[model samples]
Target: MAGYIKSPFNYTGGKYKLLDQIMPLFPERIDNFIDLFSGGCNVGINVDAHCKKFIDYNDKLIDLLNVFKNYDLNEILIEIEGTIAMYELSNTSTFGYEYYNSNSSGGLADYNREKYMNLRKYYNNIKDNYDKFHKNVILYILIIYGFNNQIRFNKKGEFNIPVGKRDFNNRIKNNLIQFINKIKSSNCEFINLNFREIEPDYYKNSFIYADPPYLITNASYNEQGGWDEDCEYELYDQLDILSSRGVKFALSNVIENKGAKNEILVKWIYSRNYNIHYIDKNYNNSNYQIKDRSKKTIEVLITNY
Candidate 1:
C-alpha cells in the first residue's frame, strides 16, 4: 500500500486498498490495459502497461483527469494554492489549526463555511466560460474542502457538496503531485462513455478491468436507481462480449453483501465457467467504513483468461 499511488479523489469503492490483492492477479505482460469503470482510477494508474485507457460515464471526472494529464505539475500547484488564498480557505499544512483558532477534532468547517459557499457560487457562475484547466482547478479545490472529500453534483449539474472539515493539507498535496506526475508521464487516454458502448474487439490484445457499481451496495452512484438489475445484466453481457473476443478481463464485484446474494452475477459467472478469486478481506462499506466481521460480504474478482 505504501508503494502504490493513491487517487486524490475520495471516491466510493475505490480500489486503492485492494490494489495489493488485485494487481498481482493481472497479466504480467499486458499490451493494452483498459479500465472500464475507472472511478478515481486507483487500479489503472498503478498498473504498468504499454497503453492504458480509462473509460467512465462521468464526463466531469474525465475532464479533471485530462486537466491533470495536460497541465504541468507546477501550474496545477500554483492554481490550487492561488485558489486557496483567494477563497481564504484554511491550509492547516502551512499553518496549524491554531492560526485559524480551530482544532482538528472540530475542523475548520465553521470558519470555511461562508467562504466555501462563495467560491462554489463563483465556480458555478463561470464554469461554462472559464478556461478548462482553471475551471477544473476550482472544482478540484472545491472537492478538497467539500464534505467528506466527495464529488457530488445536483440535478442542474452544479457543484453542490457543502464544506468539509478537511482542507488542502500537505498529505493531499503530495498525493496530487504523485497522481499528476503519473498521469502526465503515462501513455494513457481518458474517455467519457458508457461501458457497454466500448467495442471489445477493438482492444484485441488488451486486458480490461471493470469495477462497476455493485448492485447490492448503496453509494451515491448506486442511489436513486442509478444502478439496478438491468444495468447489472447489461454489464455482464458486455463482459461476455469481451470474453468472446478473447480479451482477458477481470471484474471486481461482490457475490454477497450483508446477507444479500447477487444471484444474477452468481448465475452469469458460473454458467460462463469464469474463474472466481474470492477476496479474503471485506473492503470498505457504502459509507467508506470497514464492514464488521459479522456482516456477510463476499467480495470476488471474476476473471477470464
Candidate 2:
C-alpha cells in the first residue's frame, strides 16, 4: 500500500498523522464511508470505500472540498500562479524565502508582508461581487496564505486572518494537485451539516468515522458555540442508537488531557460494549521519551464494529 496521503488544507486538528493508527482499525472493506466530522478529509479520502459522504459543521471547509470536486484544477492553478507572479513569490525568489525566515525588521520581509496584506484585502473586498468560480480559487489562496493556514472568519462572517509568515511554495502546489486528483477520483460528496442533523436512515450499511472536537482541549473551530458537553452526550446517544441498529462506527476523542479527565467519556465507554484502542498522541518520533513519561494526554478510538 502507498504511504500516508496529505490533506490540501492545513486544518489545525487534521487526522493525517493519526491515519496510520486509525485506518487499520476500520473494516477491511466498506460499501459507503460516512465521515461525520470530516475536518480536513484526510480519513475518508484515504479509506477504500466505494463511495463517500463527508459532513462537517464548518461550511467553509465543505465549500473548499466542493470547489475541488466541481472546478478544474488548471483553472485554480492559473489563479494561484498569477497570484504568485504578482507577489514575486516563486521558489527561487530570495524575498519569498526570507520573508518568513530570519529578519522581521525591513527589506524583503516587509515587502512580502505588504503584498500579502494587499492580497487579503482584495480577497475580502471581492468576496461578495466576484465570480463564484474565481471566489473559490481566491478563498483557497487566502487559506494557504492566511495566518496559520486556518479557515477562521470573524463574527461578521469575513475572512479575518492576518497575513501568514509563508508564501505559495512548491509543496502547496503539489498538495493542491494531489487533493484535486484524489477528490475528483474518490467519488466523494461534501455536505455542510451538523452531526445531529444527519438522519439515521442515511447511515444504513455505512461505516462512520467521527473525529470531533476534544472536550478537554480547545481549538479555534471548537468555539463559536459548537461542541459542548451536551453535544458530546448527544453524539454518544446517536452512536448508541446506531449500534443498536447494527451500524458500525469509530470515534476519536481525548479521554484525558493536561491533568483533567473526561469522566463522561470514561463512563460512557465503560458502560457499553464499545471496543477501545489507545492511540499514540505524541507527534514526536523519539525513543528517548517513553510512553510512560507522557501521561498528561490520552487519546482513544472508540469503536462499535
Candidate 3:
C-alpha cells in the first residue's frame, strides 16, 4: 500500500479501491504481467512484475496511455491549467455535493455549465481530428471535472460526460505525476486488443489478469458494447485454454451484485479446480463505525495457479 500508484482517471469498476485486498493474491514472483482488460491500467501498473503488458479493446484509452508515456508532463499541465483558467474554475474551491445535484442550479453553476460544454466541444473536435497531445490533455481534464469523475463517450464516439463540480485539484496532479513516474520506472507496453485476441502461448513465467466488465452489472463500459453472455463465455473459454497450457491467471468478478446473480460465473467457478478468494469490496468507513452493516456485493478473485 505504501507505493501503490493511483490511476489518474477515475474509472468506474476500477480495481484501485480493492488493491489492498487484491494485491496480496498475486503470485510472489511474476516474470511477466499481462492485463487482458486494462481499463484504467490500475492493476498492471501497480502489480510487482518484471515486465508488464496492458491490453484493452478501447483504442482511445491506449492512445491516452501513449500520450502519458511519450509527451512532456509540463506541456500537458500547461493545457490543463489553461482550461481551468478559461472556465474560471478553482482547483481548490469547495463546491458542495448539492451544486452537482440535479435539483440545484444558479449563479456560478450556470457559468460552469456553459464553460464545460465549450471545453467538451473542443475536446470532441480534438478527438475527431486526432490531435494527440491536446486531445489527451483535454481528456484528462474532463475526467477531473466530469460527472462522478467518469470518462464516458457517446454513441458517436464523442466525449459527452457533463461537467462535474470539482476542478483539476492536487489529488489529480499527484496521481498524474505518480502514473507517469511509474511508467518511467517500470517496463510497460500498451496494446489495443480484446481479451480473446491475446495469444497466451507466446510467453512463459507470465501471469494474465482479467478484469472484464461484469455480465450482470451496469457500467459505462458495459453500455459502450454490451458484455453479454456470449462474451463472458468466450472469456471463460480463453481462461480455460490458458489453464490447460500451464498459464497462471487471475480473474476479478462479482458473484452477486444487488440481487442480480452472475449464474454463469457462479456455475463455472464451481465446476473448475481453481482458487476462489472472496474480496470485501466495500471500503465504507461507516461499516467500521457501525457494528451492523449489510454487505452490498460479493466480489471474488478466481485464480488458476
lDDT of each: 0.88, 0.79, 0.79
What are the per-model C-alpha RMSD values against the true structure? 2.5, 3.5, 4.2
Query: Which RMSD does model 3 reach against the true structure?
Result: 4.2
lDDT of 3 by residue, 1-305 (tens): 57789998788888888898888999998999998889998889998888999988888889889888887777777787887877665545344435444222432344467778887887777636676787787778777878877977888889888877666656778888899988978899988987767676754668998999998777898996658899999999888887888989999998876557789998898898788998875544322223443434678999987
TM-score of model 1 (CA atoms): 0.93
How high is the lDDT of residue 187 in model 3? 93
Name the Cα RMSD for model 1. Answer: 2.5
Clashing pairs in 2: none
Cα error of candidate 2 at position 17, Å: 1.2
Clashes of each: 0, 0, 0
> Model 2: runs farther than 4 Å from truth?
87-111, 127-129, 283-295
Model 3, runs deviating above 4 Å: 93-111, 283-296
Which candidate number maximizes TM-score? 1
Q: List the lowest-lDDT window of 10 residues for candidate 3.
A: 286-295
* Best-matching candidate per lDDT: 1
> What are the per-residue Cα lDDT tens digits for candidate 1 across 132-155?
998999999999899988887877
Ranking by TM-score: 1, 2, 3
Considering only N, C-alpha and C atoms within 3 Å, which residue pairs clash in candidate 3? none
